[model samples]
Target: MINLDGALYPWRFRLVIAVLLGMVGVIAWRIVDLHVFDHDFLKAHGDARSVRHIPIPAHRGLITDRNGEPLAVSTPVITLWGNPKELMRQRQQWPALAAALGQDAEVLSRRLQQNAGREFLYLARGLTPEQGDAVLAHKIPGVYSLEEFRRFYPAGEVTAHMVGFTDIDDQGREGVELAFEQWLAGVPGQREVLKDRRGRLIKDVGVARNAKPGRELALSIDLRLQYLAHRELRNALVENKAKAGSLVILDVQTGEVLAMVNHPTYNPNNKRNLQPQAMRNRALIDVFEPGSTVKPISMLAALQSGRWQPTDTVEVYPHSLRIGRFTIRDVSRGGGPVLDLAGILIRSSNVGISKIAFDIGGESIYRVMQQVGLGQDTGLGFPGEQVGNLPNHRKWPQAETATLSYGYGLSVTAMQLVHAYATIANNGRMVPLSLARVDQPANSTQVVPEEVAKTVQGMLQQVVEAPGGAHRAQVPGYHVAGKSGTARKTSAGSKGYQQNAYRSLFAGFGPASAPRLAAVVVIDEPGGEGYYGGLVSAPVFSKVMAGALRLMNIAPDNLPPPLPEQQQAGALPGNGGRG
Candidate 1:
């Protein structure tokens, strides 16, 4: 007590007291500001850590055939996602999580490290509902799932080229899917959701938008006919060892494509081993010389120009006609000295047709072909429909004109050839083809006189009815009129033609008295015993047409009577002439 008074000064004591009071005042102001003035900002920060804006996926549209049979549909699936930072924090759980996901733990760890800065990552996609539930039941931290729709094609490879397919993110990639994507993919919605620390959704706060489901699409394809065409084309491809093939069937009266199929197809559902070549729609995309198939059209042009008549006869002696430096020969050697229009088509005489083309000039032939939809689109609006090449005839030489008359020096698609044949079946009226059903019958323009069409039809009938015609294309209960074609394939990237490669084609209409269906079959590079259109492609036409006619319940007009025993005992005419 005696030293305490000397140890302290009055000014120094007052200064120390003032410093303590200042410190206390500052602490009080800071406490009030944190608890009241900035309270809303602090609360918002806390909420941001747990709240999320989640997506609500909308269901895609259903795709159906003309009869309302489902071709493509969507099914609900789950996709598992995770927060990389949180997922990596649980190192012990990595092995278990990887096991559930069918992944290796070391790979999973590496993936997490690669995505360290990412808040969300896909753990797995396209999981079934049951599988998703099993994964969630494990209560793994940072793992969550979202509901999504996956496309399912019921027809598989049967309708692969027509229906096409979607991608993992539900976007259309090919075929009709890619063509009508906007009309099929719907709008997605959003919602505010509260998430737990492990990224699991706890509760939905409120809706931000409502999802609008896509509208259903109905195609003009008849599933039954599609199946029939697909089966026949596949069988022919396998039997003939063909590199590829396509078949198109059209309703003659309405110009609607009843069926379209291509070979070298793939299952759109399983895309693990899908190749780009397998996805091509050969019927509309591939172009080939029509070969002798154009003879009917050329004959029609001659008939239209009034320069030729059905009863007109042309001498085909030596079975070959010389044009400049080129020679056009008939497939039947030493058979025709003089042939009427009927016999010319029945024999598929190159010389007879070339002589006619020389008389009418190339402009008339080109006009007739153009009117029949050659060198033009089919108006199907398919993704890759090609408008084939048709050269101008103004500068044509005799040889070029001759070749053009018999379907060379020009190209046409399978669909275009089918359209031309359908025009003939529709009594010379050109109707626009459709891939979707029309409420009313399409308008038709008269491309050829009715009399000319009738005459051509009768002449074509002789092709199947005559003793040495396309007998393989004959339907037992009906009269079939068709032309067979065998054109050597032009070598790609070269000027000359391939020695062995050929495109076997058949184009025809059925029920001569009252035609209804027009079909075309194309077998590319058949490598088997036969490669001619009559030998390799006509049989396909006969079988498919028989099924199609019976399916549609068309009346039989030319059912053959039972042959006499003596005639039946003789060998049937071989399908070896012309084509």
Candidate 2:
């Protein structure tokens, strides 16, 4: 009986061993199916359901003045981001996370629920360091901060037009920023990371892309001059009770813009309260009739073409002359039949200038105007610059020609007129106006002959020093040459001047022996006392020019002679004769 039972037991043990071997084979086959045979399928599933890292923006470039003073810059900021997949996984901790971040738990829950399994989403942007650090310190799964940059204007309203401001994402919106966005903005960088089951960053295994920063811009503007111009213009705006004002200072030789300022300017820093009109750059964007400031250019054209001499006298039809349907009048009703070109300019005689323009022919005068950069952009690269209107021969009505001769009927920008005046100040050499510091080509074109420029400068100085000339422009210690402009602003859509609305302008350069700074100042509708360019704008020009000369250490040319009051009254008025 024992022998038979033992044989049965041995057979049963052998059967058990065979069954275990079969089960092992099946397990190995299943492992091979999942790990190797279905590798592609598993990889696709993992790719579709994984934590992905997005890119963060790089720092922007610096905007500095010629002296390396920072005009515009950027500071690091933070933005909150979320991984909906992880946020949903840790739904139990939502209350604590939302409380610390000032987010409603129920709202966050709905947001996460709605975006279930989403890889990435934005929470908030432009957060402060402390605020961002508090949220990041919570260590909530899927919630993180992205480092970024926000634009900062160091000089505030002082450099608003030059440095410009950027949008929230660091894109340029205006000024130099808008003009050179591509060069100033940089590419963003990215990284891919593997997270643990808890959504904690494990290790960075691969780089998605490289980051590039913006290129720095170095402008030709001098910060000192910019501040000076801004201060003066602001004071003028307040003192004169003006609608607006603009001032520009240029280097006569290089035509580089030392300073360009517009009053009623808004600060680029806190733009929350800015108005549309306050941010406008009036110098380049606005146009006005230039009046007698244009007289010098007309006279220059006459001398250039041998049409008239600075000394040549023209009979100025008494007080007024009718040109076609319009009557041309002078500032003063002179009891004179004849007046020299010098006398005409000195007296700011509208009728005398009309005769000169008639003799030179409108075509020649218009050609000279074009050559001198009138009725066009000066190529300064400023944004929103308007190319002002210049009526052609076919468009010029009978009254147009005469009115244009005295700086009406045609429109010009302050910068264009200043640039044209600078060409004469630079002794006929017309260099393009530059706001950025790039070397010009070796060969520069000449706009007028040297003698022609000299002749014009001489005539302009006489206009300031002449008797019965518009006064208040005399500087104590320099020989200044320029023209005064007092013209009425034309009504919109109408061909007539606006009553009591005048543009007062003074354009000049000193010390006259060798011009350094060619400056222009314009006041819109200055009231009280007098509004003529000689009375209103010239005093400002003298004050600024004197300061500029002192700052640059430019030696005085002819220190103004002592006043007759200071000394014995010798020469009677108008007896100084022609300069």
Cα lDDT listed for each candidate:
0.89, 0.81
The residue pairs found clashing in candidate 2 are: none
What TM-score fits each model?
0.87, 0.83
lDDT of 1 by residue, 1-579 (tens): 376642567777777888999999889888888788978777788789988888899988999998899999999999999888887788788888888888888888999989988889999999999988888888887898999999999999999998899999999989989989999999999988998786667898999888888889888888999999999988999999999999999999888888999999999999999999999999999999989999999999999999887889998888987766777888875445998888888888998898898899988899899999998877878898899998885576888888989999999999999999999988999888887776688899999889998889988888887888888999978888989999999989989899999999999989888999999999999999999899999999999999999999998877667889777666366534453
- TM-score of the candidate numbered 1? 0.87
**Total clashing residue pairs per candidate?**
0, 0
Candidate 2 lDDT for residue 69: 92
Candidate 2 lDDT tens digits, 457-498: 887888777776645666778888778889898888976768
State the weakest 10-residue window (summed lDDT) of model 2.
566-575
- Number of the predicted model whose TM-score against the real structure is largest: 1
- lDDT against true structure, model 1: 0.89
The list of candidate 1 runs beyond 4 A from truth reads 1-51, 195-202, 560-579
List of clashing residue pairs for candidate 1:
none
